[model samples]
Target chain A: MVEFGGWDMPVQYPAGILAEVKAVRKATGVFDVSHMGRLYLSGPKATDFLDWVLTGSASTLRVGRARYCMICNEKGGVIDDTIFYRLSEDRYLLIPNAGNRSAVVAWFQRWIDEKFSPGCTMEDVTVTTGLIAFQGPGTLETIDQVADTPLSGMRPFSWTESAIQGATVFVGRTGYTGEDGFELLVQGNDVVKVWTALTDSGSVPCGLGARDVLRLEAGLPLHGHEIDEKTTPIEAGLDRFVRFDKDYVGAAVLKDQQENGVQRRLVGFTLPGRSAPRAGYNLLHQGETIGAVTSGSYSPTLDTSIGMGYVLERYVESDTVLDLDLRGRIVQVNVTALPFYTRPRRT
Target chain B: MSPDDRRYTKEHEWVMIEDAAAKSAVAGITDFAQDQLGDIVFFELPKVGDSLTHLGKMGEVESVKAVSDLFSPIDGVVTEINEKLLDHPELVNQDPFGEGWLIKATMTDISQLDGLMSASDYDAFTAGPQ
Candidate 1:
């Protein structure tokens, strides 16, 4: 186990990262992601308060659906990327990264006090909840065996309350692994029962190491690596999540960036061989440093090296050739589109 | 268990002297090293005919979580590399002693082998004090 976000988290199970990754890609894999924060917001002004703070328009979110969104600071820099699930007309659940839980809760409280006052209530439900993610092409079949309510009709981004082993849980058809999966939020006491049920049903137990590779292969940006206090949504290529139709805290800055242009944009690249490029490695153009890698790894699925980095706007286009300086050894890389691997669409 | 036929280095590399007359030896990382590395994903190795000094940098082994430098246990000249690892790096994790052997080298100084630890010594070194 490794210390991550103040929690002792497993980096990989006994099966190892490679096997766990293969399990997720081919069959089913389960992860204990209980460290992630779950915040509950309820009140008449809940939607209004969320709209003011989150980049995505909360008022438009349909009940039982979740929307990917980010909370940005006043300077237009991303504070944290989150997913908001509209539990009901007046209630919502916001899931934030584990490390940013305290800061996000404080940010929410400040906003609530300033705008909604006593009209809205914000509760940190992280301690009381345990989160698990089941991901892979075989996720539905594996989960259906244990779910009290058949999960066949649930669409992507939709959630519903269900029971597993008689334990109440919130099941959402959302995941970060770029695979068909479900995220289950259950009472902390019931986590063991739920985990045992999933594992007994042949779901391979995975850990953070497989999770990182899976997300990187999918070209998903991790918070500290790709998006941070110094990065705006426009620069991170998350402009789609920033809805300009509604005003938000960092709306003006994002709109200005949209109208003008970003100085640097996130781009994906592939190394010619197995030499993996790691974070902080420099991207070189002809012998001059152009940018630094944010995240990289040897992609087990692609059987090659892949990486993501923020390059100057001029170098963000596809087919651009650059050299990745991996610990002083320069390896040629081709600028590719985001998502080095995409799952075959389920027909 | 470390094999009785090979000598170990402090850096976790092992050398098996194949021919004393020719001063030829085969080298690979020890099982302890592979266990610590998790799943081996990539390997950067010196090509055949490259010269290596005792305790010199030979190459690197990258796992999913980290990359560790591979050190030459003795002064030598690379005669052959395990080409199989180029396509299937997991051999290091699966068979660190046999099929995963990294390189065969013509030892430039056979006397250097005297300084290496025996299998029992290596086992003790890895096991630490009781």
Candidate 2:
């Protein structure tokens, strides 16, 4: 066990990290993501408030839908990457990373008081709710066994209200593992029942270790590593999630970056062997340091070492050769495209 | 419990004198060391003919979780590294005391083995704190 975001969470189960990662990529796995913050926003000006705070406009999001977005500072640095769901015309549920939960709530409260008070109200239901991700190629089949609603019609990023083992829950066709999956949100008291039914029907119980590896393989950016308070969304290669058509907190700075282009870009690289490049390792081009690695690991699925790091924009193209300083030993690394691993089912 | 046939070092390395008169010895990390480093995936070992310093870092072993330094228990000249570990590093977790032996070396001073801990002493030393 390890301490993550002030919560004692399992890094891996008895099956070990390799087996846990394989389970999710090949069959099915479930993650207890209850530590992620679940905040409910509602009232008359909810859409307006969200449009001002989030990079993506919640005003255009229809009810029963979700969109991935980032909350950024005035200077365009990312506060946290998140997903918000439009539950009703005036009500929405936004989920934030566990470590940034308190910060997000405070940010929203400050905005509500400054601009949208009396019309917007916020409720923190994290402690009362439980979130679990059931992810894999055959996830819909397994989730259908427990969920009382027909989930086949739900498109990616869409959600529906349902019942699981006699408990009311929200089932969303969303996941972090780059697979067809369902994220189930239920009352805290009903978590165990829902978890048991899914496991009994055949879902491997996974931990946070596999979660990190799977996300990296999918080319997803972790908040503290890839996009932080000092790193802008454009530099982190998250431009797709940023909407220039909408006015938000960091729109001015991001718009300028979009027009002028970023100085550095986040890129992916692959090493020849299993000795993976680690975080903080320097990237060198012609004996001069150019960038540093953010996340890396030995990829069991790809049978090679892969990593993502920020490099000068000039060195961001495919087949660009760079040297990774691995603890003083220089090893050659080749810049590959983001998402080193794509599911065979997807393409 | 640590095995009785070999001696141990503070860094959790175990060395067995294969042939004392021939100045030859074999060294590997202890069972406790492998257990602490779960699922080792790669090893960077010293090449044959490289000299090792007593209690000095000889190589590194990277598990799926973290990378850890491997320390030499005795001053010696490297004779051979375990070639099998290149592809199957998990042997260190499966049979740490046997097939997981890391290196074969020629001891520079036989007296270095006398200063090492016995099996009981090593068991007691590792039992304290962490």
CAPRI rating of model 2 = medium
What are the per-residue Cα lDDT tens digits for candidate 1 across B1-130? 8999989999999999999999999999999999878999889899999999888999999998988899999898999999999899899899999999999999988888889999999999999952
Candidate 2 stretches greater than 4 Å from native: B118-128
Residue A335 in model 1: lDDT: 96
How many clashes (backbone N, Cα, C below 3 Å) per candidate? 0, 0
In order, the candidates keep a fraction of the true contacts of 0.89, 0.33
Clashing pairs in 2: none
Clash pairs for candidate 1: none
lDDT of candidate 2 over B1-130, digit per residue (tens): 9899999999999999999898899999999998777668899999999999998999999877788999999998999999999999989888988999999999998779999999999999999997
Instruction: List model 2 lDDT by residue over A1-347, tens digit each.
Output: 88999899988887777788898999899999999999999999999999999998898999989999899989999999999999999999999999999989999999999999999999999999999999998686777777887785689999998998899989888999877788999999999999998889888888988898899899899988998989999999889889999888999999999999988999999998888788899999999999999999888788788999999999999999999999999999999998888888653
Best candidate (score: TM-score): 1
> Model 1 chain B, poorest ten-residue lDDT window?
B121-130
The A-chain TM-scores of all the candidates are 0.99, 0.98
